[model samples]
Target: MPRPTIEDVAARAGVSRALVSLVLRGSPKVSAGRRAAVLRAAEELGYSPHLMARSLASRTSHVLGVMVSDLHNPFWAEVVDGLDAGARSAGFELVINTGGRSPARERQALTGLLSFRPAGVALLGPVLPASAFTGASAHTPVVLVSRSSRVSTVDTVNDDGRAGSAMAVDHLVSLGHREIAHIDGGNGSQSAPRRTGYVTAMRRHGLTPRVVRGEYTEAAGAAAVRALLSPAPPTAVLAANDLNAVGAISALEEAGLSVPGDVSVVGYDNTWLAALRHVSLTTIDQPRAEMGRLAAEALVHRVRGERVTPARHLLPPRLVVRATTAAPRAMSGL
Candidate 1:
């Protein structure tokens, strides 16, 4: 069977080949009804524009590069969905790569994506230094998600990490939890603000703050739990993220402790995993999809030369209560 072409789409939609071309190119001149017809026809005929051919013919790439820090996390997948939707609507496609949460690997991934000469790049929770973004922006537009930048050429989209952490602490405190410990996301993007917020909230409540060194991984969360147990665990625990919270729960269970009974637990990032029936984790909700969409919009604006200064989007975070958090049990050892 032959592959469907633009001609086939036009014939199926009862439109001229030129009109189909215009619609495929995302020309504003096409009426909404005609554009919808052409798109529907293309979908029915399984006709996709050859991106490489189109780029070569027009000498302009419609590809946007994306570098994600951790592919294992479900949060990034949700964000990528929004990014793909936004980019495709703007007549661009995404070329994505992962850095395994390593700065060196992220630098390499960024360089590899830039080698394609894409229209722009969006870094999702990148671990790379500011210098790397500066260097990349010299060649193409760069937008960051879940990260911050002061460089005039780079744009950033982030949730309020400080406020999110503070909300978690306040919630736990309101539940009559006096002894609370936090497992921190060490060296990760936006980790500092979260740590600061945890400490500040604890001090404001007239409680001693206990912070454990950990990374944004389950293993780190488990290890931190073990360390805290030896020194007498707190009545409540604040995990770095959803994955970390799950790990902390597992470790607690292994030690004959029940979640929200023996020790209440709170997590950051209200990801899909947090909503599972078996793992109904109380968490801080970041607008993951909205952040991705905003990042894409920023890059698109830069690519189109519509803005020059910078786009700094700091979205608010919300608290999502679940089964994992509860008031401390009477006679619970602190």
Candidate 2:
């Protein structure tokens, strides 16, 4: 059977196609009685307007495109929750895609979103270069979450990663952990600031910093721990994120070392996983949902021509101490 169209709706309602269009578009000129009749007819016929077609015809879009760097990470999902809420409240819908944390794939995903001519675009933890963002921002308003940009056309929302990392280091130091190691999130967004913060804090406390090159993956965390064990493992470890910290914990337990007893572990991004009783990890908290909301607001403002200047939202981070960290074994006895 042919799909129901506006013409069919108009025929069923005994109204002109023009009147049906006005009613569907929510025009105040249409009487309430006629509007109700048209809506009832369309519903009875299972007819719905094609959003993309309407957007193209009106030269205005109600869709916002979102590209997330990694779908496997729960942190991105939490951020998307905020983005979706903010977009829907503003009479806009979201079309989401993932880039698998690959720059090439992100570029491709971005191109695909632009093809739809969405009102705006949001990139969550994108690894794409500045040039790519510059090109995209030229055609569409772009907002970045968990990433930084100097492009005047683009907006960014991020937490103070350096301060968060420093907080973690200081917490460990206060627990009498002198030999602390950091598992760094290599090549990931905001990784540099986090690493810099860890090094700065370690030096400030007159303690040597040991950094293990790792990616934002559980495997990387476990591998870094394995490497650390052979060369004398640090009494405390700061992981790139909650997922990485969990992996490090698993590796340490497998090696017959007890968490918080043999070694204390801390992580960044206090994701839901960090709160699990079994995984009760101490971590730095980034307002993931708030960042997403801010990004959405920035993109919407840009789309509506409400703002011409760039928006830079830098939120503060807090540390949540949990069961994973404690005083060093030697200090505990004293």
Candidate 3:
């Protein structure tokens, strides 16, 4: 039997073939309702996209696929800004999708991107398995940001999480914060390194390491802070990221504590949100935009066969002091 086609899907969905084509190509111009109808029809007919055949016929591809882990995080927006600028300068267009921080969804996003057979793909902070990276690299060049892979074909770009965490700890210690706590990025990418740094730095400073479980979200940070409220709250907190720090501050205020007076907080990721006048979060600054640019450059190089060795770019992170941090009240004699 002959396989299903776009025309068949269009007829089934009562839409024009162009509309069906746009839906298959994942165009945002298509209405959500129409797109859903087209997708439903295609699924019913077992229709599949043949992007590989189209690529072969065209003999050139200008599309670069991008998969982002969490669209809600402001950090990703800055990174994508750099990626977009880099890709555009290289005469390529980017098609972006988000995995919503789910490993399963990330795998699906990866598979969907691969179906397009783009020249290359960039995954931003993905939590997908190693097998997924290796499998994807078999068909196209893959570059990762905020994640690591042992696959020979994959390139990676990441900030020095361990050093960044240590910097936060050092800053807190310098402020005479002996009772310090860390809200860790539990199970998140690069969490282990950050946790290790926090522990090592606390031990070096002769302070007991108090690590609270948290994720890469504000809610997690708030919850972690709430958990720390039991016995005696720490004088300072090192959050997993900017969002988490903001959340921790909010929770502290709700608990009738003054920021930097009752508790000083340090955050990782100097995202724009952290620098706002109202937020003015003291944080570890990761070069988010630069990492994105590097990832894109590496992927484009691999696509053009310009370099063979895997690119591993690990950028340094520095501390950005702001209004959110100060010495403990005991040290200040306040």
Candidate 4:
């Protein structure tokens, strides 16, 4: 089937091609009635502008590129939703891509966004180092979500992961947990801060810190749990994120243990995954949508030349207690 074109939409709307173009570009010059007519015509005719062609011709982008580090993680989706809402409200569109949590792929993703020549780019939980991020910022204005930077070129929006981890540890301690183990998010973005927070909080409570090697995956979580169980299993486990915590729960159940009964589990990133009826996992709330909104605002500020200095937003993270965590049970070895 032949795809409908802008000319087709203009004909259907009984307006000139120029008027259609203005309406499609969201020019305020078009009257509300005419704008609605053109929009309806576009909807009826299925006429959408070719992004690359339009961007190339205008040399001005209405598109903001977003590179997500891990699409498998639901946290990024929530953040993108917020970013889309704020961008659309301000007459901008979003083009999204993912890196699948690979540092090399993230560099590729950043390169891909740059190829489109977008007005700005937002990197969500990128695995790339500070240097790679700064390099990308040189090509276009860049706002980073869930990553930090000392470079004045890159803007950053992140939840305080250190405090979030500390809060989880403190809550578990208050619930009578001493033998707590942490499943670290190895090499993942913000992993250092979380690990540091856990270590500091554990020491502050006069408890020995037990760290286990884990990545941001269910398989990694399960494997780490098994390894920890061999060397005297901790009564409570703090996982990297909700997905990891869920995986820990699964591994524990398979090993003949009950959550918050035989062992309590805590997760970071209070995504809807944590709020699931079956999951109900205790986790940290990072205000994902709010961060996205703020990141978009920062990008717009930079794109509009409203701000020269980078907008470094370090929002506070809060702990959300749920059914997955409780006082440790005094149970015998497995």
**By lDDT, who's the top model here?**
2
* Candidate topping TM-score: 2
Name the runs in model 4 displaced over 4 angstroms.
7-20, 26-45, 331-334
List model 3 lDDT by residue over 22-95, tens digit each: 78767899999999999999999999866565466556677889999999889999999999888888977788
Per-candidate TM equals 0.86, 0.97, 0.84, 0.91
TM-score, predicted candidate 3 vs. hidden true structure? 0.84
Candidate 2 scores a C-alpha RMSD against the true structure in Å of 1.3
Over 65-131, each residue of candidate 1 has an lDDT whose tens digit, in order, gives 9999999888899899889989988979999999999999999999999888889999998988889
Candidate 2 per-residue lDDT over residues 1-334, each given as its tens digit: 8999989999999999999988877899998899999999999999999877778977999999999998978899999999999998898889999898999999999999999999999999999887988899999999988889998999999999999999999999998999999999999988989999999999999999999999788988999999999768899999998888988999999999999999999989999999998888999999988988888899899999999999999999999999999999898993
Off by over 4 Å in 1: 1-49, 331-334
Candidate 2: minimum summed lDDT over ten consecutive residues — where?
Answer: 50-59
Provide the overall lDDT of each model, using Cα atoms, as 2-decimal numbers.
Answer: 0.92, 0.92, 0.90, 0.90
Backbone clash numbers for all candidates listed: 0, 0, 0, 0
lDDT tens per residue, model 4, 146-184: 889888989999999899999999999888899999999
TM-score of 2: 0.97
